[model samples]
Target: MLKSQRLIRMIMIINARKSFTVQEMADEFGLSTRTVTRDLLELSELGVPIYSIQGRGGGYRLLQERLLPPIAFTESEAVAMFIACRSLRHLSALPFDEGAESALHKFYHYLPEDSKTRIDRLKDKVAIWSPHRQVLPDCLRTLMQSIMVRSVVAIEYRSTHGVELRNIQPVGLYESDGYWYCPAYCFLREDYRVFRADRILAASLNESIDCREDVEQRTLWDLPQERAPLIPMSLELSPGGVHALRSDQWFGESIRVRDDGGGTVTVDIPSDKIPFYSDMIWRLGEDARIVAPEEAVEYVRRKIEAMRLRYS
Candidate 1:
């Protein structure tokens, strides 16, 4: 292939993966529609998963599989991935720019005719993932390192009132918004559970820890959904509270969530596992109200009454 033809291939692989049309490519390349179409076909023939769509909110996408593990991304695709990865910088503060460059090198290795300067310029202009100044504890990072290695994490966490040692076996590390969380099986509670990264007073990898590295840790999340006694209860949620109520890595799947009003939403939940619900209500304060599963309603009522007494 000529330099221009190779550059065209690079452009299709990187830039046209999403939201680009063959017609648009033809116009940009100063080629006939059939020529652009043939180029896309050639890309597919060379083990690319580029597929097109027609409709509102639809465009092209390149499917990734084990067979086609590495391929160059266009300037925009590189920028987009960089932006997305930048968002995770808070999980650990490190130089991801360098890491991304190494990743791009492997991806773009086959495209000798590609414009490196253009790709770098596009990366410089790209922005997406926002970084925060929050500091993560070294212990917390160590625990996460263990989870990445599929090793057990032992924790000494302080409870809500900040006065208790809860020991747990970490199953996974997950992040939501700006906070990191460790989902694990609590040996003290004798049940599967979720623990916040901020609350973990101590965390370490124990060499003696014995657990199945083979069992998909997602089962820990499923435990919450499959608790023998279902609450079958519902409640109205506040809009502000709605966003935070999304399932964390350990929170499991949401059965349902419906907006009832500017200040309300309805949901069903288990009473025993009401910590997630109660925590959200506490976060929302007066904005939300419980409606059904009399037990849940009563639990909310007692919690409110206790708050009243404490203030009184």
Candidate 2:
């Protein structure tokens, strides 16, 4: 094999093995030990994080933060990746904020001059805008780690009720509307609950509580199945309301456009979500009206009456 191909293959092997002697690599590559040693020295200089072990049972091993093998990407693929990373700039917090920023910088720095110019232009034109929420979820990484390891965590969380401590086995983490949500099996509730990450003041491994194996198997996609009973609801929307609702991720799919540009949203919403839908529709003012489900309409009515009394 060409030296370049051999080097790339060796990097992949090192990453997979993590700890292997020079003789092992030499045997695998059918190269002399001296040649493998020299190649290892070259890889070390190229920032592979390789180190030698002097004692018995210790061969060469990569550091904890080992370098990844190189992969080729077409210009278009590179540009697409660049755009995907750029779109996350609006998020206030990320699980790997520093790593994302560093990777973006490094990737952008190496792009061809013309690609850089194209990206510079696109930076002004394209954006995946998310609402700028000020609250940062300090426990995002902890929640992510808990999900990966299927561990129970004790969290100090502030909810609408008040601050409280709970032990939870995290199912997964997801971001929607610029906020992170952790769906977990709460020990206090003895059921699954979605906790806002920003409201989590602190999170640490709960060694006393055993992680639920069933919770670990649950995913964000499984949430809808676990929701409260679905109740049929309908909304009448003006053209402007239809336009606005078309951009809503959760509600957009339920909208059925009319011939006159107006639309109706027909959805089977969970009973517990009635107040949330009511508040959202109420904010649309005259543009939206509840067509069915007296519960949601009454909620809006009470809100309006409460506001009117406050103003009076």
Return the top candidate by TM-score. 2
Residue-by-residue lDDT tens digits, candidate 2, 1-312: 999999999999999999999889999999999999999999999778989999877679988776777767788898788878888888887765377777788788888898888878887587788777655545887787777666799999998789999999988887877888888889999988888888888988876888877776777887636468989889999999999889786689989999999999988888988987787788889899998799988888899899999999
Give every collision pair in model 1: 14-73, 14-74, 236-265, 237-265
lDDT of 1 at 179: 61
> After best superposition, candidate 2 residue 199: deviation in angstroms?
1.5
lDDT of 1 at 287: 51
User: Per-residue CA lDDT of candidate 1, range 76-176, in tens?
Assistant: 67556655654444354331224544554555554434555555555545554433534346766676566556666666666766656655566666566
Find the number of clashing residue pairs for candidate 2: 0
lDDT to native, each model: 0.58, 0.84
Runs of candidate 2 with Cα error greater than 4 angstroms are 32-38, 135-137, 224-227, 309-312
